[model samples]
Target: MKAKIHVSAAILATLCVISFFSITLLVELFGTLDQVAWIKSIIVFPGLFILIPAMAITGATGASLAKHRKGRLIQEKQKRMKIIAANGLLILIPSALVLHYWASLGQFNLAFYTVQVLELTAGFINASLMIMNANKGRKLAHK
Candidate 1:
């Protein structure tokens, strides 16, 4: 249950970021073309699919570790959060770097910058939430 929650939280956060950039790009450039918006959703799936499973697995591991944390579990919770964030960032880095290179090659404009910022902020918020959820689970486990 904790693992599932962690993954869901992480995925939700990541997707929120993706959705923000995509929807903003579409609305600004594409002007809400109904079909195109749908396409944007499709574009998100590949990342989502890749991330969801990994997060789930990581979260499961965290849950298992939590069981072992026993008395001084808060320390373990912090450790797990750091691990999860690092791993998640590792998963994200390659695609982000590639996308950065591509964007540089494309010479995109201010809107693109705004979209990137939005996406990054959203992603951070999401990752934070995932950690928070994991902590919440830890607290629950303690009780």
Candidate 2:
């Protein structure tokens, strides 16, 4: 049951980030400024509410499960989790907040685009890392 919870949480969190990345790209490419603002706000509000809790659950359950494990895969998963957490907290979250604020104010200037790019890049990296970690977890389980 615990393992199931961990896996589900991890996958949910990964999907959430991927969704954010994909939607942001679509909106940025074709949507109007109003659409961008709407997307930005949506990403921050309920999006964060969903993502942060899911990630927390994943991390907590993962740590509990991996506490007694020792191997290369375990080490890699741990390292990846740290990177994901740091990137989300340090880069992605702040970028999302800033972008939302600027976009809401109709400030679609160079800084907003620059930060949008940064957020997308960081989000992609984190999503990839989470997917890799999930693969490693499956391997660990089978072993």
Candidate 3:
């Protein structure tokens, strides 16, 4: 049951990050400024509500499960998750908030784009780390 919760929450959190990345790219490429603002608002509200809790649950369950385990893979997963969490808290969340604020005010200036780029980059980094963790987890499960 703990393992199940860990996997489910991890999947949810990963999907949210991917969704944010994809939507941001699509909107920036084809949508208008107003659309960007709307998307930013959407990303900040329902998106964070879902993502943050899912991540917390994932980490909590992962740590609980790892408590009894002894292996390098488990250590690696924990390390990766720590990095992911830091990236989200230190870079992604603040970037999202700044982007949303700038966009809300119709401030699609250099600063807005700058933060958008930063958010996307951090999101990509987190996504890649999460993928690596998931793959390692699969190997752990198989053994």
Candidate 4:
């Protein structure tokens, strides 16, 4: 049951992270936030509503699974998870806030672009780390 929850949460979290990345990319490609302000606002709703809870579930289930595993492998996974959480808190969340704030105020200048880029970069990093963690968890589960 724990493994099922852990894997499911991790998978869902990965999908949410990827969705964030894709949306950021689409916004960038579309060029000019003014053109797609509505899209950004719509995306923000899901990001806030879905991604946050998914991340929480991922962390909780991951910790539960880690408690059962023993040795250096578990320790390493824990370390990576910590980094992932830190990245989300420090980089992704803040960037999202900055983007939203600037966008809401109709400020889509260099600052907004910079924040968007930061958000995208952090999102990709989080996604990559989550993928690695998921692979490690899969191995640990089958062992």
lDDT of each: 0.53, 0.95, 0.93, 0.77
Write candidate 3's Cα lDDT for 8-53 as tens digits.
9999999999999999999999999999999999999999999999
**Candidate 1 residue-wise lDDT, 1-143, digit = tens:** 65566556555645644564465456546563454334334444564566556556655665575665565555555565665466446534433444344354553456545545555554565556565655666575558
- List runs of model 3 lying over 4 Å from the truth: none
- What is the clash count for each candidate, in the order shown? 0, 0, 0, 0
Winning candidate number (lDDT): 2
Clashing pairs in 1: none
Candidate 4's displacement at residue 11, Å, is 1.1
Compare candidates 3 and 4 on TM-score and give the better one. Answer: 3
TM agreement with the true structure for every prediction: 0.37, 0.98, 0.97, 0.88
* Clashing residue pairs in candidate 2 (N, C-alpha, C atoms within 3 angstroms): none
Candidate 4 local lDDT, 1-143, one digit each (tens): 86677677778878978887896787679757674465566557766677778778878877876776688768877888888889888988777777776787888788788778787888888898888887777788778
Lowest-lDDT window of 10 residues in candidate 3? Answer: 109-118
Local distance difference test, candidate 4: 0.77
By summed lDDT, which 10 consecutive residues of candidate 1 come out lowest? 32-41
